[model samples]
Target: MALSDDTMRGVNLGGWLVLERYIKPSLFTVPECFDKGLHDPDVCTNDVDDAYPQDQWTLTGLFKNKDDARKYLKDHWANFVKEDDIIRIKNAGLGYVRIPVGHWIMGDISPDEPYVDGEWGDFVRVVKLCRKHGIQVWVDLHTAPGSQNGFDNSGRTLPTPTGVGWSGNPENVDRTIKAVRDIAEGIKQEGIEDVVTGFGVLNEPFKGQNEAQVKDFDDRAYRAVREVLGEGTTVYIADMFDAERFNGFWDDEEHGNTVLDSHYYHVFAQTPRGFSPRQHIAYVCEKNSRDVNACCWKGGGAGGGTSVGLKRMIGEWSVSFDTLVCTKLDDVMDSYREGGEVLEFTRKIGEKRKKFLRNFAEAQMVAWESQDTGVSVGWFYWNFKMEGGAFAEWDYLRGVEEGWMPTLKAEEKAEHVFGRCEEIIFRTDDEMDIVHEFPPSDSVAPDWQAVEADDDVVVSHGESLLTKGSRERGDGIVLGFLSLVVFLLLGLGIAKKCCVRYFGGAGGKGGYQRVGEVGGVGEVA
Candidate 1:
């Protein structure tokens, strides 16, 4: 099926349905540990406790471990994100909401732990409210049974803060599939399937583990859900960390309705090339547009229908701007620590920086919408709200209110090039192989400069050449060929002229006479 105009404009209900340390740190509180010295030097490797100790910072950690405040935590689930949040999302002119949930929400994996079960009813309430407000939902299984991603957001992490949740154990994969089945089948049973646009089977499930097993497990989870949900359900799979590798996994018709989700973020951009934010923005837009489109459409060519059974979208994206060079902060959590510092730096530049950021955010939205890759069906901004206030690019509601992101729902026509087809026309059964790419962006190209090189050959643009010798050889071949051609033509013309003048004359013999025969006649004269 083709994408609708409104389908693409959505916001993630982050930190509300799911607990992320950076988005809602207070929810991960460990009040009992307050008496203990800040960070308890022994428990946390980084002894700085401007936030909760890393060990007690995740949703699963807050319940499974002793320091986690369980009593207060249960109450947080009800109060953190309310019905009003859903109303606000609708009012923001967004038509979609990506609700992230952990597998534990289905059942307590560790029942012996002191943690009481959370109200799964809260999730049902959120999904219902979103449906009531006409907002399509993508129920994303953000945290799998094993920490899919070895991060606090994964619901649990290793004591050393590594994520080893999916240890290739058969049980981990089984539990995860069961949880996904519950969520997908539950949505179907509720009779609200129309409002539920898709079910994301996994979110960022990557660890330094067996790559092959992980892929098999991903495919198995999707197949299990498809088996339950049937051929009509839209199941989305997070490209298992490497989007390119997992691009065509769901190309088969048996996969049913599916889309590949990959996140696009620039906080991790490294700048040895000295790219300014503007240049970096251009580079990402161009590069991802190509890569994502390449991933989406696979068959005869781009927009090719060999893979119409599969589709793609950016399940998570953000306008939060920071390079490794600017703040040395790599992840959102690290950036959260120094948000105020970055804001202060922005304030020093007055509105100049803010203006640049607003443009940057719009540029990103435009880029994703106009992707050359088989079209990014739609994208969900990383978050709708966060604790970081105006500086938070993850917060889509704030970005729109603050003038960074464009409002696509209420507009007369889609503004982005890729979004020009607000009313999508699906291909006929036979012509399904045809697909389209987003229009190219009208922006300044990246500024490139040659750097001092150590190697004899330098890579420029995308080619390698022995410049001096190559140029000389090319010129020599052309000049030499021209000279030979000219000599041949001149010699042929002279021979023709001699034949015409001597042989064609009145007394000319049919056969030619040599100069030596004429010399012998001169002796008689």
Candidate 2:
């Protein structure tokens, strides 16, 4: 069978639980710490940054016993497992929901009250919701305790900073593998279809001490997951230390029943914070696809890989920008094209961006499916939602498009957004050979109305992105001047070596003269 299931294509459900900035928010929490930490005796505000590790960023525990953690999940189900979440996933036409769980949810990470017997129900509810909606669920071990990825994304970090290869500790290694396997067995036992479609071993593997260590960790995880679920489950492993470390999985064929999940972000080279969400998505999609032509050989493309499947399912991607603003730039922010000139100059930038957003969304869709990287599954975004920081609107997207419209009210608005997402895949799904796609010009049409500024509510073009940034259009004048300077320097180098300016050098010992005039055989000078 082909390594992919096309029927599963649609919007992704992310950011629902974890993104809430550590489970409980002030106003959002029913048991509100109404008084600021400054006023509360139970809370101590240490102005000293080091005294309080960044761990303070989250109110969640460093690690909780599996049972208590499980109970907490069930009690908070209404908050974390909102109805809109289910609606959004289904409404968006997505057949799968990849829910990321912290290691605390799996007893292995907590070790004390480890993943308690009943805590599994929180996930069971999520899985059941998917089944109820005809959606497949893929469980992602998002935040593994002990820093699989030292960053906060891992949900837990070493009480102290340690180098990579936490697996070398033997205990950690055992726990990590056991967590995944237990999850697999848990779902299987529940009669839930988690592994029937897929499940991820861990979020992104960490960037630590040694290459061999990561591989060993990967191998162990592979063995562990395979143990409980056997052939029925497809193990998904995120690329740690970039793709090269794990690229061997497909080549060596050492791994079986697994899909290599990978991620892509444009910050590696493109301008930093320069790309809006749409721009980032479009850039990643374009860059990945543009890179696909070179996928014929690794090290040739920007990402340095040659897998058709990897290119198509270039897994996780995200950007730091307002979602409503990025996607609906022009139409939401009344454009200069539509009315006033100042508004045009004030928001002409918005006009230009809408064009880019449309193109970007389409391009990403094109790039994602343009290849076969021997991976058909295990791909997910950094998250589907967030509590406060607007890294993305995945939570909102999941809720509105997949959650509310489909599940709660089955609203038309939800249907429209889902339609837009579907149109993108329809335009680029490999199954649809883009050879017959609309011509490139039509392929990148602009929708000026997308950001017309309604109460400046739906969009923020996000800092003027130079509308006239082209050479012929007088955009890169400074850069053009720099290019000229470089060319002049190059020309001088050639002249120095080839133009040869002759000079008198010791006329008696090292005399130099015009050819015929200087040579004794010809004419002495």
Query: Which structure among the candidates has the greatest TM-score?
Result: 1
**Residue 352 Cα positional deviation in candidate 1, in Å, after optimal superposition:** 2.1
Candidate 1 residues 424-499, lDDT tens each? 1000011111111011111222222111211111111101111222244466665456434533543453222222
Q: Which RMSD values do the candidates have, in order?
A: 19.8, 18.4
lDDT of each: 0.53, 0.41
Q: After superposition, how far is residue 143 of candidate 1 from its true place, in Å?
A: 1.4
Supply the global lDDT for candidate 2: 0.41
* TM agreement with the true structure for every prediction: 0.67, 0.57
**Candidate 2 Cα errors over 4 Å, as ranges:** 5-58, 62-75, 109-119, 157-165, 194-196, 252-254, 267-270, 275-287, 290-312, 319-358, 371-379, 385-525
TM-score of 2: 0.57
Clashing residue pairs, candidate 1? 147-165, 150-163, 293-373, 293-374, 303-435, 305-433
lDDT of 2 at 280: 40
Evaluate model 1: give its lDDT. 0.53
Tens digits of per-residue lDDT, candidate 2, 108-213, equal 5343322233445666777777777777666777755456655545643444334453545667667777777787777768887542466677776655546576
